[model samples]
Target: MAIVELLNQDMKQAMKARDKETLSVIRMVKASMQNEAIKLQKDALSEEEELTVLARELKQRKDSLHEFEEAGREDLVSKLNTEIEIIQAYMPEQLSDEELETIVVQTIEEVQAQSKKDMGKVMSALMPKVKGKAEGSRVNQLVQKNLS
Candidate 1:
């Protein structure tokens, strides 16, 4: 099923199950997908674009989770973690650290990225391959670690 349609079905299930956390997350994701479609001047997004939207949503929650952790707010942290888990259910299978490392190494060699100066070149080439499957910060860190 198209991601949007799947989301609608899940939303109904969440409502029936009285799962507030899941329902809220799904609603936010659907809204984000719609806003992205509007920005692109399209009625609907391709699966690739839907994955991008889901990745963005996951990133936002992760960043918030980090801040909550820093603030020492366990209550909020737990809630954000739950939100992250709900969002993650819709994302592509994440690349393992080893897999991501191998890809980063290959990309570095392919781009002849000798040093940090070529970070952007390597990243532009790498991001498309990793996209929704890996976190950008993790990929960038691996790239930097390999380059340096």
Candidate 2:
């Protein structure tokens, strides 16, 4: 099923199951997707666009989760973790560390990236291929590790 249709179905299920947290996340994601569509001058989201929105939501939750963790706010950290899980369900399967490293290596070789100076060259080529699959920060780290 398409993402929009799956989201609607899940929204109904969440309501029936009284999963408030899930319902809230779903609603927020649906709203964000709609807003993205409007920004692109469209009436609906494509599969790729839906993935982009989900990835963005996941990134935001991760950033918040880090802050909450740093402040020792275990309660908020747990809630954000749940929200991140919910958002991740709608995203493409994440690239494993090994898998991510393999791609990073390939990109480095392809771009002949010899040092940190070539970071941008490797990343520009690799990100589009890994976008929504891998984390940008992690990819950058791997690229640096491989280059130096």
Candidate 3:
């Protein structure tokens, strides 16, 4: 199902269940997606575009979670963690480290990446392949490890 459609169904379920947290997160994601579609002058987002938006939301929650942890705001930290979990439900299954490493190695070889200097080239060529399935930072670390 499209992310928006899935969100709508979940939103209804949350409302029925009185799940305020899930409802709030779903609304946020829906609004974000609608705003992105409007900004891009499209009636709707492609699956990849939807994935991008979902990924952005997940990243934002994670960043906030980290900051909250550093600030010792345990209350907000738990909330952010729940938000992260909600957002993650819509994301593609994450790649395992070993699977990601194999892909990274293949990409490095394909790009003929000789050293860390070719980092840009490797990443540019690699990201689209992994896209929503892998985090960029993890991919970067793997690339660096393979290159050096």
What lDDT score belongs to each candidate, Candidate 1 first?
Answer: 0.92, 0.92, 0.95
Q: Which candidate tops TM-score?
A: 3
Q: Which stretches in model 3 have alpha-carbon errors above 4 Å?
A: none
lDDT of 3 by residue, 22-65 (tens): 99999999999999999999999999999999999999989989
**Model 2 TM-score?**
0.91
Which is better, 1 or 2, measured by TM-score? 1
Number of the top-ranking candidate, with lDDT as the measure: 3
Q: Write the per-residue lDDT of candidate 2 for residues 1-148, one digit (tens) a residue.
A: 8888999999999999999999999999999999999999999888888888988989899999999999999999999999999888877888999999999998898988889999899999999898889888999899989989
TM-score of each: 0.91, 0.91, 0.97
lDDT of 3 at 44: 95
**Candidate 1, 15-130: lDDT as tens digits:** 99999989998999999999999999999899999999998888888899999899999999999899889888888899999999999999999999888999999999999999
- CA lDDT, candidate 3, residue 7: 96
- Backbone clash count, each prediction separately: 0, 0, 0
Structure candidate 2, residue pairs in collision: none
Off by over 4 Å in 1: none
Tell me the TM-score of model 3: 0.97
